[model samples]
Target chain A: MNLPKSVSIIEVGPRDGLQNEANFITTEIKKEFIQHLVCAEIKEMEVTSFVSPKWIPQMQDAAELIQSCYSSIRSIVLVPNKKGAERLLATNCKSAAVFVGVSNRFNQKNINKSTRESIVEIRPIIADLKSKGFFVRACISTAFYCHYEGAIATADTLALCQEFADAGVDELSVADTIGMATPAESFSLFSTLKQQLPNIMIAAHFHDTRKMALANIYAALQAGIDRFDTSAGGLGGCPFVPGATGNVATEDVVYMLERMNIKTGVKLDKLVKAIDIIAPHLSRKIDSGYYQLTKKRDISV
Target chain B: MNLPKSVSIIEVGPRDGLQNEANFITTEIKKEFIQHLVCAEIKEMEVTSFVSPKWIPQMQDAAELIQSCYSSIRSIVLVPNKKGAERLLATNCKSAAVFVGVSNRFNQKNINKSTRESIVEIRPIIADLKSKGFFVRACISTAFYCHYEGAIATADTLALCQEFADAGVDELSVADTIGMATPAESFSLFSTLKQQLPNIMIAAHFHDTRKMALANIYAALQAGIDRFDTSAGGLGGCPFVPGATGNVATEDVVYMLERMNIKTGVKLDKLVKAIDIIAPHLSRKIDSGYYQLTKKRDISV
Candidate 1:
């Protein structure tokens, strides 16, 4: 199984992670978290989301959080709609992420829009962002399976991916938002996407719900995908999906990649320290296996 | 990637998992745990070890546990040396597991014998067991990396495996006692072993110390390994090796395989219920991801 010499990890803790957290992280702590992550050499990160504060009150300070997190690394923000896009425009950040669910039921439940409607609705926003020189990362939520709709058709997911690519999106992210994918499904889906869209950059975002996230990441790597969306301390889960776990822990992924001789451009011990900074602020225990292992270092090799 | 249509799981939780617990589980509870696992259609299991009670107080009732767990399923017992082997010989159990670390330092520390000496000592024991109609599972601990000696040479591991095969052992088990093997290494090791010993059944026993156990299993499956040693509720760890996590949770592995449409003759829900039976009895928190996921059933897919 051939793999890339180096892999790029896009940390999504601030937005995807903290959003699922019950306790609102103070703006100062969020900024410190980002600063520590940048110290660990994370070049790309989703600093926060631009969704309406009324819906996700925790992200109420999205603009302020972004303003506070001044870093050399690329700062990407989640934009759920044209309003979110407009809010992102006022910020200094030049990168934004938009989403359209492959499962129509999920789209309806998550964004109150159909999958196609989400695509149609986000098209102008994506174009608007691009016109202003913003890099757009179009994410397909429930790319593998949806809690509401069960298994998603590969052809349908590919069609959504193709729509995003045609919209001139800078990147495409296939997300297992519900964390229901197996390694076989991950390998087949990502491999087919890579083969079909050789020119388009594809990224994988997996959840640890079923504990297959890292395994899925490994399979995707074998299928030639080197970019991933991860969260520090293994934070984040969907508020909509039941029993959904957090994203593949950044620490665990980095450990696996570094051990395999695949460069991740991140320091393991430093990353764990970064996790330590935000762990106490969170409402729940950190779920990253690597983080857990580090805490019990007394028993380790 | 090609995978087997079905796989066989050898449950090691009762022996490997319990052996590491600080609290001693009663023989009656162990018997009940074994019965529950058998209800889940688990055909193979390590019921307990026959080591001296003085060294491993937890397994003091190994003979009584095995005698109580009388069933059609293949109940294997761990035998450390000739004395343990003689004790197993007196029991109704017809299968026994013997192990030697490929890393000499680990062998010395774990078994108080060097690798070569341990092999020499077990040669006659294996022959005697075979003559007495006992099936022997020769395990090579630290097949990937050793906690005491660091990296174990692949050649040394393979040489030990070759010796066991020549001794007419019924099966060969390559173990990642410290969970240090990567997918590439797991694939390479198992693929090479399968090629060389086409007629011998090869089983993999992995600890989840680094959280790569399931990923390693996935890679090994691709390499044509059909039999695995798993623990129900992910129970297991090396008492001799510090920082080693439990085996890859049997429920998690079964979930992955069944999702991929590979049959394991085990029911996921039933297995979880079985784990619930032993959860309160465990001294520490259950280490299986699947077991933990089951606790928060409110967020499931």
Candidate 2:
């Protein structure tokens, strides 16, 4: 019952959401989607990633998309390496995100490197970003469970997060990458992180593969963490992770938070509208609960 | 973190799940479905309802279905009135469930009576059933939010549950009939109920309309609730409530419970098979998290 008074929603639909989409959405429509999210009052968002277009053709327009985003919002672009970080620096984006999976197998499969090697490579990148007065967000992927490695050790995840904290990253976005985390694990992990590293901002990112994303977010809230990374219309899944599905839907998160009397500074009606921009372009149906319910009412009316 | 070590799942797919299906499943199929649930080790089940065939023709074979179920499992039948109770009395079923809505408007629309009137009619029936040594479960519907009346008063729901407890019902199945209750509301209401009616067995029934059922269940668990009403493959919704969807899936519930180290005494893999018997006849797809994930894995393999 002792939940936070308010929480921040870090929208990731344009980046994490659309990255795995098989059908390529035009740059214009992606911009329109980001605009709708802005009008919904999303203060922070991962607009796109600066990774190689060969890896994720869906994100080929990353630079063009990030350049078109509203400067008023904190637009974050994922940086996979020094080259990706350089690409981010070329753009007007002030916030950059880096990722390292806790599991060695997942890390190797994702970026052809071990967990230790990835951390070693990214440590200087984060420090350099901080020195350049840029906001750095370390995306700790597979923090709770990995698709290849199974249930991750809490100690290993905490150690990886501590490495990012020491690297002067402004925030840490810990993810339940395969969506296999229970609320108990979410509470236990986040509680320790919050207690151990009290000053750094921490955001809980969850996938909806098992439909426990909202429940996980609720547990994180109870653990005294207020920031969340959500995708619009519950779009996006990890292409590298087999059976992985969408991120927790943005509209659903806002609805749950506002109902609990916790302010998110995001408009539900407008947020739902944002999903409409990209829903038709995708191969999958908009399966987010709130979005489907809204469409049902639309059809019934 | 102070969760119960074990929980009981009351399978309601037979009655609550199939009652709304437009297609009439054969009596033999219904019996097979119940048999599969028994294989899953479901100790309690709401087998069928004894309502008029004109209202719910799918349950027209209620008596025949109940007679075919295993006597080892606790098979419950829904008895709406004196006539239904009389029908139940004719069978070997030992448990009977009766229901009343907390909202007067919802009550009037559902059964053409006010909440108080429905309660008055059911009070004597409950007493009679208790005298006959039949186990009685009072389903308090619209306990949190009503589709017709918007948000329901916590005080009104508590008072209705208290009336049922005093009527000597063995258990109370409190429900968010419209699938609109928040986790905070679930925790607060159940906390108060557990405090006030400490001796009466209370179970939480949630619909996955907004995909918040699991979160609400987690919250209810935090409030010390160890019993839940779930449907196989996430079947069932209130026929009278517009836009209401499936009950929380039993497999998904068992997955979450078992993952959190809380026992439900039900085999999830076998429980999933129970859905196969009824899935083909359902109007909607089996959209429960765990069920869909299993199907996805099946397709991939």
Candidate 3:
């Protein structure tokens, strides 16, 4: 029953959410989506990623999205390397995120490097961002279970977190990349991380592939970790990791937290509206329970 | 995490799951669905409900289903009143479930009686069944919240449980009829129910309306309640309760329990196959997350 009075939700629909879509969403529509989120009082968001357009065609308008929109709130963009970091630095955004998979096989497949090599590559990027007075978040992907490598050792994930902490990252996010994490794994992993690294801030990122995302988020909350990465309309999935679904829905998370008397500072009705704005643009159907429930209400009423 | 080594799953698909379907599924298909669940090692199931065909045309073949399909497992049937119980007596099924909404407003709308009046009607039914050596389970519907009544008082729900327990009901099922219960609410409610009625068995039943069903189940497990009422392929919703969706998916529950190293005595693969068997016969999409993932895997593999 012990939980934080308030939680910080980092909305990632524009970046992680749209990047996996089979269809292309126009830049104007992306900005409109971000505007909807901002209207709903989502202060922190990953607007877009600065990865190469050839790598992910869905995110081809990353630069255009940052330049045209993302002025009112704290916008965090994903930067894969120094090149992506350079592009992010050119934008008006001050916060940047970097990801490194804990499993070697996953890292090799995802980022084309071993865990050690990826860590080595991101160390200077973190230092450079810190020197520039920018907030850097290091995400440890596949922290619990990896589709390619199977179960990952906690020691390996923690060591990666240690590396990020040493490199002076402002915060760390543990991701259930393939959405295979159970509540027990979520609690134990996040608890161990919190206990080991008391100084570093921790965020939880989960996929709903196995329908344990919200449960994992609840478990993470019980472990004293508060910040979470969520997607509006449950819009994201891992293209590289087979069977990975969208992040836990933002409206669903907001609803649960608010009902429990926990503060999320986000309006549920407005969040649903935001989801409705972009729901038709996506190729896949929205997988959010709250979103679906809201639609049902609209029809019945 | 102090979870039970083996959890009991009472499958309610044949009754609760199919009752809300818009399409008419034949009794043959219903029996095949029950057989698939039995093949998946499900030992306890609610085969069908003995309600009026006029009330729920989908469950009109309840007697024929119980007579033909349920042989190897423990079968439970839903009986709304003494009349329904009379029909249940004609069948070979020895277990019957009766429900009353915890909220008076919900009970009045759902069953055409006040909460207390509904309890009064079921007391004689319980006495009649117990005298015949039947296992009677009393379900408190809308235990946490109600669509018409909004948030229900915990004291009111516990009082209803006391009434049922005093009436010699064998077990109690706390249902979130609208799926509005949060993790904290689920844990606190079930924990209080367990503490107040330590001798009586308690089972958690939830709808996934707000997508908190599994999270609520995880919370209930933390509160030391091991038995759950789950519907296969996440079927079943309260037709009277607007915006209420399916029950917590059985395959999803089994996946979480097995991954947490808790035994459910149910095979995940076999359960998915059971869902696959019935997936084509349904009018709506299969709402189970594990079932969706299995479909994706099927397409890819």
Candidate 4:
């Protein structure tokens, strides 16, 4: 209960968010989203992903998003391979995020490679990125549970955590790909990862599918992992999964951390205003607890 | 992180819920809710409050809510005074819950009496209920922060907690009256309460207004408090404040606990189904996060 007073928040709405949406956002809207993310003053924003357009056509505008971004922000781009890393490296982006899936079936189902093959493929990509002197953060998906292969063990995800650490990735964030973790699972996994790789900074990425995302973040905090990935207005859902919900709402996470006397270096009212800007463009309700609270707060105030 | 394998959930939706709603629910529907709660196999349910109908017209049916029960259920009724306690004692209710706000200002605002006067009132009420052979649980409201007077130090709520324990009450449920508590504040209060009165069971009542209710519950659990007060579909908005949300959602609590491998003695699916019965009666959207998750779940499955 007695810990350092404040923690940092890593905002990932622009990148992790747009990648999961089915509709391809216009280059202008994607650019605006990034601008709004910057306006929120969230220091570590993951701007875009350089994955195959064929796989996730929604993010085909990655280059334009990066090209259009303002220079005052510190952003990280998700790059799938050396080609994507090479593409990202061409830009002024100083950091790139690499991904690996814990479940073999999920890796094959999602990214068109076996788990082992993906790790092998990622090593060179990470090495090349590191060699380029770009800050690297590795992401491991399905760390909690797999859609194709149910409940994953803590040891499985910890092994990949070791692999990422071995890859010399500066930071690692575990993604609850299918939103299947309990608070206990989240705490146990993060504690194990921290124990094994203390030098590697850890971030949490959670889907709000079962409404356990924020709770999972809370659990991770207990395990001493403070950084997190959240989407503005809860923008994206996995189209492949019929009923998956959006990512953890950035506003909600900030609201929680701020009230807990934890600092995330973001202004809440401005974040709500930014979410309001993005709400009209989305087809669904803003999947955020904060959006609702803020909306109510606005009317009441 | 590695503690008890499971935490128990106590649902207080019907009593805490119906008492706060603006609409008048008939005795028949109240009976249906009781039947539903029993069908859900919820181990503990706060069915109604034994307060003066003149002051709280919404809770006029406290005696009927327990008397007209169509199901075999162990019910607890909130008692505000000896008269109300005498009335509820006539019924088969197992426990009588007495309440007093910890803050002098909140106690005055909520019960129209100072802390000492409220305790003086609850003493006779608790003694009478105990004499009648009814189990008793005491609730201390505004234990964290008050809307009128923010910054309630842990010492004040702790002093109230000890008073409840000394009163020979069976359990104590602390409430964040205006949804103003952070996890740190909740942790500090609950840990101190457990340290002082380990035998007096502790439960939590939280509002999701600030989006910390679930995490606040998590913090309380880490502080070794298990039981909680929750409203199905997050039904109650504070009547005094009008449109202000109150009481954590029962469904969200079940979702968090079940995922954590906690045994709350409540059926998640049945609790989900109970939402339907309550949602239509609601004039506004239910604030429960699990409501959206469950709706998606039913459609997907």
In order, the TM-score of chain B in each prediction is 0.97, 0.98, 0.96, 0.93
Candidate 2 residues A144-236, lDDT tens each? 988787889999999999989988999999999999999999999999999999999999999987778888988999999999999999988
The sequence of per-residue lDDT tens digits that candidate 2 reaches over residues B1-301 is: 8989999999999999999999999999899899999999999999999999998999999888887556898899999889999998888888999999999999998888899999999999999999999999999999998887788999999999999999999999999998888889899999999999999999999998887888999999999999999999988998898788889999888999999999999998888888888788778899887888777752221
lDDT of 1 by residue, B1-301 (tens): 8899999999988988788787888887888888889989999888899998888899998878887545689888999999999998888889988999999999998989998899999999999999989888998899999887888888888889999999999898889999888888899999999998898989998777777888899999999999999888777788887778788889989989998999999977778888988889887787566777778755452
Best candidate, DockQ-wise? Answer: 1
User: Against the true structure, what is each candidate's TM-score?
Assistant: 0.97, 0.98, 0.97, 0.91
Q: Each model's number of backbone clashes?
A: 8, 0, 0, 1
What's the C-alpha lDDT at position A94 in model 1?
Answer: 93
lDDT to native, each model: 0.87, 0.90, 0.87, 0.77
Cα lDDT tens digits for candidate 1, A75-95? 999999989988888888999
Worst 10 residues of 2 chain A by lDDT: A292-301
Model 4, span A1-301: residue lDDT tens: 6544667777777777767666667888777666776777878888888988998897888887788546676688888876898798778888888887898888887778898998998898888888988789988888888777777877788888898889889999888877767777888888888788888788888887666676688888888887888888776766544566678888888887877778888987777777766667666777465677556632331
Best by TM-score: 2
Calculate DockQ per candidate and list them: 0.65, 0.55, 0.62, 0.40
Candidate 3 per-residue lDDT, tens place, B232-285, comes to: 999888888876778989988988888888888997778888888788988788
Candidate 4, residues B59-78, lDDT tens digits: the string is 88777667753335557788
| Chain A TM-score relative to the true structure, per candidate | 0.97, 0.97, 0.97, 0.94
Best by lDDT: 2
Question: Distance (Å) between predicted and true CA of B204, model 2?
Answer: 0.4
Better of 2 and 3 by DockQ: 3
